[model samples]
Target: MTELQRKLYRQAFALALITIFYNIAEGMISTYMGFQDETIALFGFGIDSVIETISGIGVAHMILRIQQNPNTPRDAFEIKALKITGFSFYILTAGLVVTSVYNLYSGQKPETTFWGLVIASISIFTMWALIWAKMRVGRALDSKPIIADAGCTRVCLYMSVILLISSLTYEITGLPYIDAVGALALAWFALKEGRECFEKAKSISVCGCSDGCH
Candidate 1:
């Protein structure tokens, strides 16, 4: 492997590790905070993080596999992995949207947890850093795996921004619906990214496209 590829692989692995840690933290925080606030969005955010963590790990695994089998046919595995990653976001977003709308109609107030907000903010900031690093590595290496990993981190950033907006807005406005609105916005973001990723994946010509193509 080239030096650049090696660097990207290392970076991808690190990002995956971070993703797992962040998701675990999110789950704990959300669980603690959700019960206090009676807000499903808070809990949902943690669930979303878990998904992101899994996606990140999956991307990392694919990167390792591709590196080991640099000659492996990239036809179905690559395309399918990308599609699965993209679909994950779609499902997450759709679920959040439904939950947000339901919460709005049900008229439930979000519980205020200053600690939760603080931890979430910190977590989001860290994710942003990781995303920035991933993007740089992805560009330098021209590695699709790295790029896909970056995309996962980017989504985490988006999720964080939405949660930050919703939680802070709630604090200021005393409007619980704002949080739900923020979640809906996040859901839309997930859908958009998912569709785009799927399209990109579909457009790529895989190895073994035809007989002896690889």
Candidate 2:
């Protein structure tokens, strides 16, 4: 790689590290606040963040691997990470589905969705920034794996929007089931993420593209 490309690779690797740390921090805060307010959406969102952290580690490692050799296949480390991320995502999906159903049937209501609103807003901004930066670096390097990682960030942006809307709706209408509905919405995304993880593992490319990670 040329010096400029190497620099871009460094940037890409840094972004992955940023994503991992941010997910960890977000997971802790959201889980705590979700428990305090009993907001299923926020609680589930927190769990998803934890899963993202695992995926981020794999992504980070992929960046390092490709930085050294762009044509490399998914290594054992990346495959292991993807498998863990996939299974965790499936478990979270199942748990969210069960919890959401029970909450709906029990007429459960959160004390407040205030924390959801806060976390979602912050996440919206953070995810957007990360997506933009990752995309820029990916395009600069002409790296498919990095671009696909950016796509994943876009998914997180979508989830944040869901959380924001659900939190605001519950706050505005005082609806008892809105939180559960939001959890269900999140569960759909969780299922998609889980499936993507497995698909990526099936592909040789780090991004799961059959042609190549580039």
Candidate 3:
């Protein structure tokens, strides 16, 4: 790799690490609060964070491999990772959809969502910052996986917004179903992302391209 490519790879690596750490922390807190309050939306959001962390680790591993051996043919690994990420998103979507429907049917309401509000609010800003940085680096390198990772972060931003709005609305109006609505929204977004990721993977696989497939 050229020095410039190396620099971008290093930046990508750092961003991936940052994503992993942030998501882990966010996932733990959100999951705990979600279960404690019986909030489907928050719990689903936490699960998404965990999946994103896995995706980030895959991206980080790819970046490291490229940095170490610039000529490595990354087609196989990239395809596999993309497929896994895409499949995970589909799983998340299914879970959220099923849970949301159940909650709606049972009229389940979250007992307290103050923590959900705070967590989602914090995640919004953090995700925006990470998205900006990831996009900048991904665009600089014309790296498809990195760019796709940024798109994943963008989905997280949307999820945070949904969580914040739903939590606040429920808190204000004491409407239990709104939480399920938010979860359904998350499911839709996840489905879209999953399809896109799968398509990207398919494209790369068909073209037999490496890391610079873009």
**In lDDT terms, which candidate is top?**
2
Backbone clash pairs for candidate 3 read none
Clashes within 3 Å, all models in order: 1, 0, 0
lDDT of 3: 0.86
Please name the candidate that would achieve the greatest TM-score relative to the true structure. 2
Tens-digit lDDT string for candidate 3 (161-205): 999999999899998899899889988988887787788778876
lDDT of each: 0.69, 0.91, 0.86
Which candidate, 1 or 2, has the higher TM-score? 2
- All candidates: CA RMSD (Å): 4.0, 2.0, 1.9
Q: Per-residue lDDT of 163-186 in model 1, one digit per residue for the tens?
A: 777777788888868877877876
Candidate 2 pairs with clashing backbones: none
Error of 1 at 53 (Å): 2.0
Q: Provide the TM-score for each candidate, comma-separated.
A: 0.78, 0.95, 0.90
Where does model 1 exceed 4 Å of error? 2-8, 75-88, 113-116, 200-214
lDDT of 2 by residue, 37-132 (tens): 999999999999999999999999888888778766778788788789989999999999999999999999999999899999999999999999
Sorted by lDDT, highest first, which candidate order results?
A: 2, 3, 1
Model 2 worst lDDT window (10 residues)? 205-214
Indicate the residue-level lDDT of 213 in model 3. Answer: 61
